[model samples]
Structures are given as structure tokens and as C-alpha cells.
Target: MIPLDEARARILAGLAPTGPETVPLAAGWNRVLARPIAARLTQPPADVSAMDGYALRAADAVEGATLRLAGASPAGKPYAGTLGAGEAVRIFTGGFVPAGADSILLQEDATAAEGHVRVNETVMLGRHIRRRGLDFAEGAELLGAGRRLTARDIGLAAAGNHPWLTVHRRPRIGILATGDEIALPGEKLPEGGIVSSNAHALAALVASCGGEASILPIAPDDPAEIAALASSGGFDLLVTTGGASVGEHDLVQKALGRDGFVLDFWQIAMRPGKPLIWGKLGAVPVLGLPGNPVSALVCAVVFLLPALAKLQGLADTATPTLRALAGVDLPANDKRADHLRATLTPGEGGVWIATPAARQDSSMLAVLAGADALVLRAPFAPKLAKGEPVEVIALAALGV
Candidate 1:
């Protein structure tokens, strides 16, 4: 069996980002940018007031000084006339500062009566004014390519006069669950048959990682059925759960091989998901995961998440992990790398304490669901006592 890192590298190397598509600015949030968003126009296009105040010449805004009220300048409405000596213009936030005005006297600092205003505080030059292009200049790069746009980025893009944005098309994934013993939820079950959960669970994982998922019909154990269903193309990547092992019933590799599927690798040195499959069926890639519910989801977190990120043109595809203290003593690991499902709790000094569940059966979905993180134990790792440091992958942080 190949090491997990090599397996992951091979899977990512076989994929390329989806092509770019133009989308409305409102729909750009959470989508990876295909092209950099350059400012179409400067922000605060001209000198504007940053606060509600009176725009006037600094030389005439001294304490106890009275100046004639010139005109009013509200947001989106600028005073046409310039301020003269001993003159002030009533200006509100976002209002353009008229020519010949170099300072702002806050309204609270000045009292206006009839046609004259008295300054209670001395005004400083260039104070409380948002200068032209203060936020961003025309032609400046506001958002870079490969970035996942956020709400703040949308606002900035709007302020930069962008009505549309170019982003990568969401990756399309086809999920296939194979087995005769498993049936869809709520379907009539044969004796000893179980409800299928891997397809929908993996579909949710794909969606959380920004990929579009399509659940294909369940393929029975027959090689012909698996081959026929897998050959019905129109997907960027195909994910199959179950039927990956060497058991007589596990026929994913055998079935796909009939359709000229080139095998990259099939096994990895990892617990609960050793019978993993990664290969190419003609132009489409296929990732066959283990049948066990826990193993399927864990493998998805390890392999599928990065594949989705790469397909979306994201700059970083590495799975993010956090450091936590072991809440219980851990046993030494063997050759296979282990992902121990554990619960996390806040500890002293902002540290997290992770305690592995007593039973970690790969088929038990309840224990996996109650887990907050997966404590990573490298192959041949030595035993550790409580309070020792450990690296953990936070599940909720990944939106799984």
C-alpha cells in the first residue's frame, strides 16, 4: 500500500481547474475568482467629507470666529460654488469638499445662527476629509485571482464599480454508491439490507467544498452494472463508495477496468480506509472509497476536500489542522496512519483538549458524528500521555 501523502499527491496531480465563467457581482460571494478584480474607478473619486461638519478654509476656522454660511453639501450632492474667505459650507458625510476648503469644523464644534456660524473649536487643515482615492485608486487590484470572494469583497467590488465578476465554474462531481446489501433510505429493504448513507453524506461534503454533486443510482454488485453506470459520462470527477476491496463482491476496480479505466493506485496505509481507489476512466477521474460509513466520510475529508479546492482554482488546497492537547493517554500506532475521532473541549490558556472516543469502529456513524475533530496519528507514532500536544483536524471548521 502506498503512503497517504503519495496517494493524495497523485489524485491532485490528475486534476485541473474548471474553466472560467462570468457571474453577476451579487453571485460572486464564496466563488473563487478566475480573474483579478481591478478597480474600474477610484473610491472617494474626489476629496469628500468623512463626517458631518462645515467645510471651510482652515485660516478662518479659529475659535470665536464667525463666518458666513455659504451652501449645503449632502451625500451625492456637492456644492457647485467654492468656499471664499470667512465662508463655510454645511457638509454631511460622503459629501464632496468644495474647492478652497482645506478643513472641516464639526457641526457640534460650531453653532450656526441666521447667516453666520461661530467656531467653538479651532479647525485643523486636512482634518476629517477622505481624500481622493483614499480607499483605492483606479486600475488598482482590489481582489486577486484564485481568491474566494467574501461579503466584504463584494462590497469593495461594488464600490469599485464592478457589476460583474469572472469566477471559476463549480466542479461537477458524480457520486456512485455500489452494493446489493445497501438500499436508499426509506426504500423497501431486503433481509439483512441496510440503508444507504455514503452517497448523500459525500454529496454534502462535495457541496461544502464548493463542488456540485450528482447522486447516481446505486450500482449492484454485478461488474456489468457497475461498468454501465460509470460509463454514462458528463462529470468532471466520479466518486464511488463501496466495492473497492479485493473481496469477490468488491468489483469497482474490476468493473471500471472493463471500460479501460487506468489504475493509478488502489490502497493506502491508513486505518478504516485502506481499500481506497484512485484512477482515471478515460478522461474522467474516479475515487473509490471504502464501504464503511465512518471510513467513507474520513476518506472524503482527507482526499475529496483538497481535490475540490484544486478544481475550484483555489491557491491553497492543504487541509487545515489545529494543535490540541491530548485529553487521554494514546497508544502507539502501527504502520498504518490513524485518524482518531475525538471530542474537543476548551482548556486553560486558549488550548483545546482532545479525547478520543472509547470505541472507534469504522462502521459506527454515531461516534463519528459526535466527534468534533480527527486526531492525526502518524504511522509508527509512539504512545503519549495526557496533556501532550497533538494535531487535529476540526470537522465543523471544514463545514462537514
Candidate 2:
């Protein structure tokens, strides 16, 4: 079996980002940018007031001084006439500073009477004024390519005068769950059969990572059935759960071979997910995962999430992890890397304590669902006692 990192690298190397499409700014949230967004016009346009105050010449405004009230400058409407000496303009927040005004006397610090205003405090030059282009300059890059648009990013793009944005098309994923003993939820099951959960779980994962997922009909143990469904192209990537291992019913590789499927590598040095498969069928990349629920989801987190990120034109494709302390004594690991489902608790000094579930059997979907994190145990890692530091992937943070 190959190492997990090598398998992930090979899968990513075989895939490219989806093509770009234009969408309205309102629809840009969570979409990866295909091009940089530049500022269309200078922000503020000109020197403006940052507070509700009176715009006046700093030299003429002094403590206990009175000035003639010229005109009011509201947000959208500007005072056309310039301010003369001993004259002040009534300006509100976001109002352009009238010509010949160098400072602002806050309304709270001034008293207004008939046709005049009294300054109780001395006004400083250039105070309470926001200069032109304070937020951004025209043609300045506000956001770069490969960035996923957040609510803040959407606001920034709108403020930059962009009504539409160019983003990579959402990667379309075809999910296939194949097994003779598994039936759909709420269906009459054969004796000792189980309900299929991998397809729905994987589809949710794909959507969470910005990919569109279509769950294909389940295929039984027959190679012909598997091949027929897999070759129905139009997917950026085809994900198959089950039939990846070397068992008699594991016919994914064999079935695809009839349709010119090119095998890249199969199996990885990882616990609960050693029977992973990475290959290609014609133009669509194929990733075959173990049928076990825990194995399917864990491998999806390890490999499929990064693959989706790459396909969406994201700049960073690596899985994010956090540091935590072991809550129990861990035994020595062997050749396979381990991903122990664990619960996270707050420890002293702001450190997190990760305690693995007692039953790590891959069939226990409940244990995997209740887990807060997956503590990573590298191959050949030495035994670690309680309180030892380790790296972990926080499942909730990844929206798994």
C-alpha cells in the first residue's frame, strides 16, 4: 500500500479546476473567485466628514467664537458654494467637506443659534475628515483569485462597484454506492441487510465543500451493472463507495477496466481506510472508498475535501489541523497511519484534551458522528502518555 500523502497528491494531480462562469454579486457567497476584483472607482470620492459637525476653517474657529452658518451638506447632496472666512457649513456624516473648510466642530461641541453657530472647543485642522480613496483607489485589487467569497468579501465587491463576479463553476460530483446487502433507508431489507448511509453522507460533504453532488442509483455486485452506471459521464469526478477492496464483490476496478478505466493506485497506509482507490475512467477522475461508513467519511475528510477544494480553484488544498493533548495513554502505532475518533475537552492553560472513543470499529457510525475530532497518529509513532501534544483534525471546523 502507498502512503496517504502520495495517494492524495496523485488524485489532485489528475484533476484540474472547473471552468469559470459569471454570476451576480448576490450569488458569489462561498464561490471561489476566478479573477481578481479591482476597485472600479475611488472610495469617498473626495474629502468627507466622518462625523456630524460643522465644516469650518480651523484658523478662524476658536474657543467661544461664533461663525455664520453657510449651508447644510447632507450625505448625497453637497454644498455647491465655497465657505468664506468666519463661515461654517452644516455637514453630517459621509457628507463631502465644503471647499475652504479644513476642520470640523462636532455638533456636541458647538451651540447653534439664529443664522450662526458658537464653538465651545477649539477645532484642530483636518480633524474628523476622511480623505478621498481612504478605503480603496480605483483599479486597486480588492480581492485576488482562488479566494472563497465570504459575506465580508461580497460587501467589499459591491462597494467596489461590481454587480457581478467571475467564479469557477461548482464541481459536479457523481456518487455511486454499490452493495448487494445494502438497501435504501425506509426500504424493505433482505435478511441481515443494512440501510445505505454513505451516499447521503458523502453528498452532504460534497455540498459543504462547494461541490454539486448527484447520487447515482445503487449498483449491485454485478460488474456489468457497476460499469454501466459509472460510464454515464458528465461529472467532474466520480466517487464510488464500496467494492474498492480485493474481496470477491469488490468489482469497481474490474468493472471499470472494461470501459478503459486507468488505475493510478489502490489502498493506502491508513487505519479504517486502507482500501482506498484513486484512478481515472476516461476523462473523469474516480475515487473509490471503502463501504464501511466510518471508513468512507474519514477517507472523504482526508482526501476528498482537498480534491474538492482544488477543483473549485481554491489556493489552499491541504487539510487543516489543530494541536491537542492526549487524554489517555496511546499505544505504539505500526505501518498504517491512524485517525482515532475522539472527543475534545478544555484542559488547563487553554489546551484541548482529546480522548479517543473506546470502540473504534469502523461499523459504529454513532461513535464517529459523536466525535469532535480525529487525532492523527503517524506511522511508526511511538507510544504517547496522557498530556502529550498531538495534531488533530477538528471535524466540526471542517463542516464534516
Candidate 3:
């Protein structure tokens, strides 16, 4: 058993970044950029009007000056006439500022009669003009590599004149389960059978972490059948939740070894999840999690999430750590670090008060649903007093 930090570092170090592929801009959202995207054209490209008014030479707008009205210039259409002293062009918002025009006096600010207009207020040069390339210069870097594309990123890409982009391809995960004790959900359970919820939960977990997940049929704890199924290829990662412990029917470890696979870490110093296994089968990374539903999910959040991020060249994910005051006094364990399920409620002083659920058992689903965070209690921690501060991991961060 090792410290949790040491275990995380080891797992991260063994992973590699994913490769890049070109994808249509529409489908690129939530994907990481493979390279910098530079602007292909200048925004606005030319001086344009910022409002519907008259475009005139600012110097000609002397206190009592009146200007002859030129042709109208609406958006997407520009007047051929140029502004001169005592002359103004009728311009609408987004219309090109006619050549020689310096500013615009809104119609509300001037009096119009016949073919001329009167300047009712003083105007400044360069007012109401959107200069060429003011928003973004041509060839400017608009998006950088490793940046996650959001809807906003797509809009930025379109603004940068990019119709498509290169991004990291999502990893494909294969999920398998080994245990005759489990049966598929929605089917009648046999005398000693239980519903197989872990595989579906794992599949959902993989997708939330940005990977494509496929749940294969369960492999009963038969050594020959397990070895054959586990050795089959076609996935970047393999995940199995059962038969990972030291029990006699725990064939996952032996099945991988029988096919010449190298094991990494088999167990860690964590409660309800000490018998986790990780290794490589051929070129695929394999994670054998414990059968306990909550335990499997916790391990997935702790390990699999980081693996997917690593494969996509994403930065190390920061867990949502919150400071909370304990609402109850509790005894402490000395070896395995505990992740106690707790219900959080808003408290005074801008803090959250965490009340550990009464049923801390790993297999209790009803109590887990009511929990919004897992209060992390360190191994060997002394008995905690009520109102003491403790670090909590937000359940939402795990994509629960």
C-alpha cells in the first residue's frame, strides 16, 4: 500500500496523450484543439458606420454649418459618393463609412429639411467609425493548441474564418464484467443472482470522461472463458469490475497474466476499494475494479477520469475541493483512507456544513443518492470534533 498521491502520480505517468485528427467544426465542440488557429481575415475589413445617421467631415460640422444630403448607404451596400465640406451621406448601421467621411451625427441630433441637414451638436473625428481590423488583426492567434472547444470556441473559429478544425480523437473503452453472481438489469434474477449495474455505470462514467464506451456481455468466472474474452482486441482501454480480489473465483488477474500481460498496481490504501487492479493487455490499458457498485464508481472517478484526460492531451484535472465544517463528531480509522458520504447544506460564514450519512456502507445506494459530497478523512486522522474544518470532494465533480 502507498500514499494516495504516490498512487495517482504512478498512474498518470504510465499514460500517454491522444493523437489528433481533422473534424468538421460543427462536431469539434468539447474536443481539444490540435494546433493554433490564426485569423484568416481582418474583422470589419474596412471602416464602417456604427449607427443610422449622416456621415460627414467632422471639421465641416462648425456650430452653424449645414450640409447637403448625399445618397443613402445601408448595410451591405455603400454609396458611391464621398463626403466633402458641408456634405453628409445618409448611413445606416454597419454600412461602409463613405470615403472622406470622418464622423456621423445621429439623425435625432440634427434637423433635416429638403436636401440638406443641419448639425445641432458638435461632433468629434473618428466617432461612430469601426476601424478596419479593430476586433482582430489578420494572422492573429485566436485559439491555441490544447484548448477545449466549447460553443464559444466554435463561434471564435467561425470568426477566425475556420470552417473545420483538427482535434484529439476520443478514446474508445471496452467494458466487461466477470461474475456469475450478476445478471443483466431488466431480467428476472435467479435464486442467487443480482443485477449487473456496474458495467452500465462504468460505461456512463467513461463517456462523461470524454471517451466512447461499449459494454460487452458479462464473462462468468470461468478461467478459460475469461481469458479468451479479455485477450480479444479492438479497444484502447479495458475495464472489468469483479474477479479482481484474491478470492478463488477472482480470475481477472490470472486471466491477464496467463496471456502474458504485465500488472501495474493491484491494491491501494483506500477503503471499500483496496482490491483494485491495473495493467496492460497487449497495447490496451486495463482497469479491474472491485465489484461493489459505489467502490467501482469511486475508483473510476479517481483513476479512469485522469487516464482519459491524459490520453486527450488535457491538463491534469483539478478535483473540486471544498472546505466544510463537520456537523458531527466521528471516530477515525488508522490505515485505509476513508471517503465518507456526506450531505451538504449551506451554512453561515460562507461555508458548507457536511453531515456524514448514517449508512456509510459501500453497497447502500439510497444513502449515496442523498450525498452531494464525499468528505475525505485522512488515514490515521485523530477523532474529529464537531465544527472542525475538513476537505470535501464534490460528487458532481465525479460526473455522478
**Candidate 3 lDDT, 78-169, residue by residue in tens:** 88877777799988988999998989888778888999989898888888888988889899999988777889989989988999898888
Stretch of 10 with least lDDT, candidate 1: 183-192
Give the CA lDDT, 0 to 100, for residue 149 in model 3. Answer: 81
Candidate 2 lDDT tens digits, 1-400: 9998898999899999999999999999999999999999999799999999899999988999999999999999999999999999999999999999999999999999999999999999999999999999999999999999999999999999999999999999999999898888888887888999999999999998899999998999999999999988899999999999998999999999999999999989999999998888999999999999999999999999999999999999999999999999999999999999999999999999999999999999999999999999999999999999999999998889
Instruction: Give the runs in model 3 whose Cα sits over 4 Å from its true position.
Output: 60-65, 107-113, 330-333, 383-388
Residue pairs clashing in model 1 are none
Best by lDDT: 2
Q: For candidate 1, lDDT tens digit of each residue in 62-157?
A: 999999999999999899997899999999999999999999999999999998899999999898999999999999999999998889999999
The Cα error of candidate 3 at residue 32, in Å, is 1.6
Summed over model 1, clashes come to: 0
